[model samples]
Target chain A: MSPTTTEDSTSSNHGYAKTSLNTVNRYRGRGQYEYQHVYPIIDEAPILHVAFHGSPDQDDFAFPVILPMLGCTGNFEEDPNNDGRRSIYLHGYVSSRIMRLSRKNPASNNIAGAEGIPVCVSATLMDGIVLALTPNHHSCNYRSAVAFGYAQVVEDEPERLYAMELITNNLVPERWQHTRYPNKTELKSTGILRIDIHSASAKVRAGTTGEAREDLKDETMRTKVWAGVVPSRMVYGTPLPAPTNMFPGMPEYIEDWVEEWNEKAERYSAEAAGL
Target chain B: MSPTTTEDSTSSNHGYAKTSLNTVNRYRGRGQYEYQHVYPIIDEAPILHVAFHGSPDQDDFAFPVILPMLGCTGNFEEDPNNDGRRSIYLHGYVSSRIMRLSRKNPASNNIAGAEGIPVCVSATLMDGIVLALTPNHHSCNYRSAVAFGYAQVVEDEPERLYAMELITNNLVPERWQHTRYPNKTELKSTGILRIDIHSASAKVRAGTTGEAREDLKDETMRTKVWAGVVPSRMVYGTPLPAPTNMFPGMPEYIEDWVEEWNEKAERYSAEAAGL
Candidate 1:
């Protein structure tokens, strides 16, 4: 029955969640989402896979899992089906913090609607590989998600302004009021799109690798190499505010997210360390 | 005429290549590719692209571009009509080295075919991100390629013996003869898939950022943040051989790639220091 001495694997299930575009099932596994053993699943998940309203923190809706700081929306292509999928196509512009510095067209402050470019985005940071001692136990640990949805361009000035507020809030959680809002011409040049949630699934392989009985008996294979999880984590230090900005203070919302990120990071690091 | 100030100017050319994929006039731009700035154009100037390939002396592919170790063969999707496109259908797999150490799979050897599970293959690394000061200028300087095609199980006793030699020679070159080939059963269980190199694209963005005229004039904008490229590169120190194995001489192939990789690391270090 062991993978080494035997050919037929009775192990059937590759534990992973299956879902559509609306409701995401909660996954319960030995490891957390940020486990270092996680592998990046591209075909199964995409950033815009689900289009949902602005409540990014709520569960079951596919939007919250993704970090919204990066540019998520692009030009909207009306769905041919009248079923109201609420979708937008993105160009491959990796709209990250660096994009803001480029300022290619100040007119089109947002990469979308500017030059009619679509966006395809992907972001991942891998930490370590988890080897399950058993062939069936072979698995990777990682924290990842793919979101896809259509964003409708907020063309009306008032709507665009309102959308910008939501975006700024999304990133910093209350910095909109602190910074000056865009003017009329600026509003016209800017692009804003609303995304709707569709469906999402999460896959994970955690805990110790499963070992075959035969291989364990073979002493030659016992001490071959350094076998242990290399712990990895994305740690965030306190923000260093800009010199020019006179801020009321760090908003609780922003603080809350950072705290969550840190707590999750600690958990992942501990798991990776096998502590 | 600047984007910041230009309100109603019209330029019909969106910088897209004229002619269709179906026509012969543009075949040059389609079949053979060349780089015009960051945008890859086909055949407009084939000479410039291949110019880098000839020089074996350069340490890094920075000045002269280097072709990927393995070129992809087909369209990203499993398109039926894309003949001679040279594509690869790759599934991810954990290497034998990691498998044995993690205590997973008691199999004596962790190579593909040994376990009968699908072999996941990859040979790629991300080199760097080339950040130009301008947003449009920002691009990642990365090295990546996917190997496609499935492995043919090494069946012939003699051929299987030689196949392990081939893998070592392919990876470390010249070292195959120095090491012993895998045994009959070792070969039987090992999976060997022939990968096809079909359609592929190599992209890079280098040089300074595009400074907008308006930003240059606006001291407020200029003084705002720390701008410019963040140079990143993967530098491998001398390889630490597995503690179990003892090597008396180095193979020419392994010797050659290491030297090449080091040269690249040196050049990147120099560039970073200059910045």
Candidate 2:
């Protein structure tokens, strides 16, 4: 049921402009099909992966099922980074198997194009390792995206409670006004889908990690190699509770959202590995 | 070419003991196919999506291409967690397209079974978020892993210099004896696949995040929602260098591998979220 504000607005308003299925043929200058660069790398990826085309009439044992779902981009009306509307959603388990193959092929049965189940979502993050001085110019400082969607199966119930409160405030922020809302057997064993993207790309690779010029004019391989960038982030630590928690501590919005996502994941992974 | 000491030592020595393609049909007790719980969650995952099945004569527009490669899991003879005879390898870029579709399908051309190019290989980590008490028992103290392989295309050169010194000591440990080794035109534009794995699992889902016993005897919905866990990990900061790094700092093996993987990812994510 497409129209959940599928944001296309006559493309190219600061890129996301590629077609031929979300182009980015080999680092094409760090591709970036925009909706503000692929919805903030699919809303700061904590997990997306997805892929698809599983068992589709098993042609040569056709099996391409990459899972790790749980998603979020937005649009129950606004801010999914408000620009090019939005879509993405995801969440799972209505008897999974990609929501029973996105409810048996839907995307309005390919209105002359990309039908439902042809997924391929993805999302990385990394943010540092680089260390290149050779070892074939090693890399990692990342960001990654890749969206090409179609999905469907989000049968409205106030847009599935506004995509479950935008995926539970994208995991934290006001956690859907403190849980307990999805009853009716947890919205009938949950399952959300929605995608509708159809052209998304975002490859980042942040700073520090470039070497060749004959290994930076080989001063004995630049003083016996040791380029840089360790960076890498993702924090949050110290919270725990739960074993029948008769709460009395840890909750000031989960300790200010674990110190605000550990200081924005250590200040954007050391300002994107420039450190 | 599959024999750079291919591992498989007469199977079943402690986990990775599932077939029917690495079975774990939904939380079968947090399925783990063992080799010490799946090669330390495939060597502490910091990227390894990889899925596959791309062209397959384009059935239903078959496109399953999850990327984020750069892998680990070893067996250059021993310690790939020293058991199930490891495999995984990965690395990319020799005219990439998944190393030319794993060198045109070569799992010894399916000698009566699991053929090449099948691939799957996932990997996650997360370690904490839980916050249950409903929201369908919100979870995510993760660990993931998937595996099931076939891949091929490595074409030995001392097993591609032992998988480029085990993926440059997996990005930092002994930083592969300080770079510059890959020479022959950087080993002819490097490639490396080698999956071969065949049956691997590992689901995990560490402590705290169980709700449903009438939302823990509903003490006003557990003191107005705020179950627990948060935790998460992955740190490794401070390093930065490279603008033509005429190296003069940051390298005592990259600051002891960023303080030993940031104190083993903050003490195994606060002891797997039991904090």
Candidate 3:
């Protein structure tokens, strides 16, 4: 599958393979293990839910923490969507819990006899709510991806900068180039994590709702209940100028990006619902 | 906070209070601990990320799992938003790991009696991306809520039904009344977890983007960087009937609900960005 430069790039080629960690147990048919399919969903998502075991050595009580993080998947030299090999780059405060943990446990697989923090990152985009005649059949039309990887702190300055640039561009194309580059102080306070993905899977549920055959046969129930797909799309409204913005008006790039995303969101959502 | 019958009832009063578990450490000013403020965000969100610690007695590796679950906040008697006392009702498959774990460890406050399953439920609604002249100041205008609670399997039949009804209504108002009621078999296969919220807090960042004073003073940086809020909203598109739907077109309730939610999503998003 080729990646679509639009929102909800659900149609993409196989990139990751089925692994024990990334296998979709419940809805096997909807699962796509290829990197091409999984990376797009990861890239398109605005936030990634990072989950890790809290206090792994403690046997008294186990707590898992999941934090909403800003991240992107790509290498510095290649486009994330088109390239087969991609790593997730997550940004956090230098002294953050996740960052500190990652620093202590650096990636060692390549060097042998090394340990790294294990993390599971998940991203989801809801396309529509599938309303069925029966409540049992009600489902959501969504695109979701889960990735298992080892995360390590980025010690290299160039690699960290590259990751930061990728994350900024992920928010808005060419946003990094437009914004003031990070200074030494800013870079010192920020921490970057490079998650080397071991396995990943993408699950997509699209099209119309599915009703039970028995429910359809029941005329009373069929007439009384409405079964359909309520397509949900993320739209970008008109840009609002900042209080400190001394500029005359919103810039052309901001306007163009908003318009482009709005159109893509509507089109992709419609397509997902088979409109 | 009185719950609105209409879609996206963003207007509500304070409900929950500050506690040790639910306090916002990083940005204290943005934290809101009132039930009125927290419930609406939890209700408006499409999905809740449920995080819990994996095996407590194991000396081996610990794993934290985060699952996207369908849920709502309410009591049996009154509207959740209006009522000060509320519990989060989460719906899931009976055989799911979270459900099984929650059932094994019932919530108990007394010492040495029993260990309750501690869980953190979080919901986030992204309003817009706040582009700034400098990368350090860039942020997202969003409303997020985090609740710390002890989760236990809901065994009481009436409360279970009530929770089910609340969750169904959350999907679309009065949805439970229209769809065929669940049978004994259906109810048996499904499980509901009542998270008795001990503490909760909401963090909301709204209005336009904020640029650094230094960047604002720099004329060239100000002119080059486009700093503004690109409002993001989730919209509901035209409903599409299922192939098995023998009914004549979409129902009026479905049509009205879709239009109402679409408007609310747009309105709330714009308001969050101070557009």
Candidate 4:
């Protein structure tokens, strides 16, 4: 159900929109968010982070809702018109000490606190799995986005410990300047929201292979039972370290970002090691 | 919020039960059929399908209604007693003919369909992509599955061409007696839908470090940036055949399934001829 609506906020500037960090987030129910673009003013942009997974491991409770550009070297390719890697995204700017750690977690207590929907948060990472031969036609091949707007919370105190050290040095740029920052009760129980530049939108869909149109010598869509697609990704390798890090070398920007993550882990490990 | 509910339907029909192949077509949005853990007794199992794609080359879309077995394929060592791969899937259950070709598309005419809501599906395939080390903490170390029940719509005619020749011989086993079967206008414009397995589940997560809660000795969860996870799969090498058939050769069950996909491609061919 491709629905849409969300623009009327004129000023009151809530931030977001360096082209809304390359929009795409879809995972309905439990913090609902949607914006399936068949086209609607190319869907707006704002709101960013919402990458959850407190469990089932993905590096537990992953975070990314830190926005605000300026001197910017979260090197999203140092702004190729803020490339947004393909589409756009950049949500969460929360910093009221993480909204009092989500109001001391009773799970973000009352009136739907997470500080009531700030603004701009778009995410989408459903990249592939179209195994069809029928088991209710196993499907999946996605990439979504529709982050609306919010984040403006970094409440002073040394810019809330420099926006939590620019979100831990923009997510571990060699460990936020040699670590150990964030105190004063971890910056008074962390939260730092921010959004503006016109809230979010990053419409996408690589829909190809609708296949199924046999008869012309009927090749049964070339079946073998193990058809195609199983790509799936979200990678980054070569960090290991920390066996009690006294640092046994390795760091020229972590050996050139792990030789570019061993060349994208040797081309996605030779197609999942099945060359 | 966990919130479970099942207090009866025969106690939500526990594990491996079956039924539903058009039992008086009870119209739920024209043509009813959909069930997971097909309620015979008590609990939950709504549909789940999470498919995505937009890059890594795109074509993504997956329907998820929270943990409803992404679509099924049980038989984990032949049913590990109703934990049988801890069910939560929603795959092709024999491709309900691509939701009957998106119920005559007009952008799915006005979805709200599946009034009979009972659909179990599960799918898994992600040989790798575990790249960690903070890039907003990357992850993807998987195999994945979980499916639970309900489907009915095979409208007679010899159980709809013997359930499309048992899903084309469960996906190509001797090409359903060497091809060519569905006649009566390809079984009345082929719609076929059937699933009756009261409760079912399947599970698997797979390697390259996935145990979680080592909590990496939390110095703020390590992060020199560049952690691991970037495997990914969908291998089914050797098995070409059908260039127009006539291979008076190749059939000992297609040479034992192309010698079991070339012995899993020569034991994952050095991670598929790495890079």
Candidate 5:
């Protein structure tokens, strides 16, 4: 059965409501609108593709633009209303921050629209390539989440640090405490954007190749052409120390984290091929 | 030396002009606009994140939206002017086709605006995670490409088939010839979008951790904390056949492609760590 149609998945508790904009009309069976289903995919993706309107000043760019950014989902505080809404924090430099959220643009201030710069964030993890009998039926086994929201720069120093730490730890577990803390200049130069989720949904596909009934019945074609999934995932190799690194050896936390993630990624992709 | 500053890189031969709209202002040292430099990144990426403005009828949505799609860059014909211009083809279903490029949007027709649906496509490959002495200095070693374009549905059957075959082969080398041919119904059901790239650029960072002079000078902190790159890449695992697959055995082409890609992935991630 599809999780999209399941009862628990439809619960509003700590879940995003399906809006006309965020609803997944195609492949409805694979669509999900729950926080549990959506957030993990976003967190697992190393790079989040963020899309926003180009600077209004640049009329040549009628198209919206996309910037691949480092970010992850996290909540700074528990939901006061018990309805669990969270934000995605992003890491950026001062120049990129200025380019994206220029003062010249009215809506960039989040004042005109009463919301921050409109943006959409997407994350996708390709589990495998599903090779079918014919090119038309070829598909990908992937988990993708799209989040629609307004993004505003985190001006508050504490919140900014909170986001920076969260983004850092997300990349390497327990990395924040292990690394040297940021000084005043480093803190000032680093920019963080917190995107408040307005609506979100996820679509997942994990299984073997899908065959049409007609194609499956054609023994000659079936026997001639191979049909299968080439399972795949991002793998973390052994860490390579920097030239100036003076640590006695690789830290236990880093070593273990690498192994754990590699195992998990391999296991999931291989298992998903069978599912 | 940075490619962006090179004279040959600035050549207009089969390359996009460095417009203000597409310029990489933040890290000018890493930006690239050449065809050879940018197209491969998009083709190598398994998934492309596409962003475009919502339909005009959907006033409720002020934000641009992103869709994770399967696509690859290809040139259907040689450049008439000897200046390389290529298009990226995307595979989509009919249902999703109508939702994204509806009749209601004026620009969707490419008539009034003299351009089809405006779009921005991004592809990124994270080579490794750079663990620095401080959290602020932590960065990702990656190759990322951003393409700005106008998309129009491919109506010509031959062109659509060309794109389809290209996409299928891109997934697995020689896959199209080995598979069963698509029927008329199958062909009709598939939707292909050809995005004529207007401008594009790529950014690459591949190396060990970048350390601050002050942090490097502090021997105590350097001795205590680990600094390195955790090389990472998308690895293709063993192939698993479908339940209904009637192939006698795994094909040699598939096997070779898998092995070759897996080796390339592993080698690149590892070598890029110390670059």
Candidate 6:
């Protein structure tokens, strides 16, 4: 698993340089430029929001397209071209538009031979709903991260399999091994987009509601309103086996993982709310 | 609540025109263009992923910036210029970059009176984890929607209040009335961007795993692997009171809402898995 230490840093303040591109303008205290703070948000998020221009040509469409995609961050040990930083591996179909675009256009970044298309992948984790004295003061406690990079399809067989395993196991631990192995056609058809990061940032808003001084002073309003946070988390219910399944119910691996996930998610949400 | 009729339609086949801009080319069967199918996905998602170029000049950055924002869909009845279609109202701070951008730039759409900066708002609801026979076929059951629109700040006080109430209550039922009303200062400082949608579409993927025929034929592999969907949903836990809170326990309304939300969310997720 990717390291997720917020308070302790193994590396000494290593992060993206605060340029105009990666800086968080509003609520500056909540903004984090560190690798530990940002990468964890991307790895933990259930879904990633990816945005890219519809076509390789800039003039083709004025609006950028946003699609919900499944992906996770990983470092491929064998890839000599990899810059050592974790790259995002996105699970998609071979025929998807994003995959086709990435294959068509190589990135024209300052790097000597970067191969990819421009893209931004973002993820948000909602911890709790903050309710204050007034509607304006109400906010949701969240951890959000955005990474801008160049996305290219993984052509190497070993690298593609690595990404496939990384993504599958990321969703459910040991899921890659639990399932049947991919055949030749299946392996060929699966598309994995590896996003080489250029710059990124993470923003987090935690703790109880921050109310206005005027509202807090009003005794009547303070007493009348039910002010606090409602903790929220993604809960995994009982796994429903497919009709063709020979087994009667969820296997021990699946059930145990689901239980542990629900427990941790619940604990984190409540912890964020209290903070 | 916004209408959520998937199989039924209030109007006779009312939907956005099928344009190359909003088509789901990859999965044709899952694509939906109807108003009922699209708008609900935007409303139900916990947070919306909003994307727009960092600058109005466009050439400054090759990648579009993505931010997570809270919002809901509503139609303004009082506005004479209202096109009768639902518009997304985003809750943001007055000094936020998006709020400032919306105020500075007016949409250059064909409509003479249209005012706002161009934006794309997308939302995704993750229902379940679909575990297929092979890792290659592994997928998630999801409902996703994307809406392209022009977002302008709501200058009108009444319209602004409408949006505030809509957003507050959408996050929590009857939350607007329960809390202290927004004062003039609070109202003035708050930013609400109403997005007048131009084109939108929804895509949904549900049901049991659809595996390869070749994989299903292998009895040994089928029996060894456990394949199913792990249903998932956002669960609201008990109200976590802030240190400043006077109340000893959660109010009846908060308790009831949390209970109902958990039940509905759980039910829907499991149902989607079965479908």
Best by DockQ: 5
User: Which of the CAPRI classes, incorrect, acceptable, medium or high, describes model 6?
Assistant: medium
Q: How would you order the candidates by DockQ, starting with the best?
A: 5, 6, 3, 2, 1, 4
- For model 3, report DockQ: 0.39
lDDT of 1 by residue, A150-217 (tens): 23334455544555554344333454553333445444444444432222223343333344455456
Q: What DockQ was computed for model 2?
A: 0.25
**TM-score (C-alpha, index-matched) for candidate 3:** 0.86
Q: Indicate whether candidate 2 or candidate 4 has the larger lDDT.
A: 2
Going through the candidates in order, what fraction of the true interface contacts does each contain?
A: 0.00, 0.68, 0.60, 0.02, 0.87, 0.71
Give the Cα-based TM-score of candidate 1 against the true structure: 0.41
Q: Tell me the number of clashing residue pairs for each predicted model.
A: 67, 7, 14, 178, 1, 2
Model 4 spans with C-alpha error above 4 angstroms:
A1-123, A126-131, A134-138, A141-152, A162-172, A175-226, A230-251, A258-275, B1-275
DockQ values for all predictions?
0.04, 0.25, 0.39, 0.02, 0.64, 0.55
Q: Per-residue alpha-carbon lDDT of model 1 for B1-275, expressed as tens digits?
A: 11122121111122212212111121133221211211221111111101011112322111111111111112223334322232222111223222222223222222221221111222223333232222332233332221111222223455434444443333333543443333444344443322222112332233323344554565554443323333333322233222222233433444566577556554653353233
Query: Which regions in candidate 5 have their CA more than 4 angstroms from the true location?
Result: A1-11, A97-114, B1-11, B79-81, B97-114
Record all residue pairs in model 5 with backbone atoms less than 3 Å apart, i.e. clashing. Answer: B14-B84
For B194-270, candidate 2 gives per-residue lDDT tens digits of: 77775667788888777777766679768767787878887887887866777677667678768888888888888
Q: What is candidate 2's CAPRI-style docking category based on DockQ?
A: acceptable
lDDT of 4 by residue, B97-149 (tens): 33433223312111123222343333333334333333222333332222233
Question: Quick one: ranking by lDDT, best first?
Answer: 5, 6, 3, 2, 4, 1
Chain B TM-score in each of the candidates: 0.45, 0.38, 0.87, 0.30, 0.91, 0.89
Ranking by TM-score: 5, 6, 3, 1, 2, 4
**Chain B TM-score in candidate 3, rounded to 2 decimals?**
0.87
Candidate that scores best on lDDT: 5
Residue A98's lDDT within candidate 4 is: 32
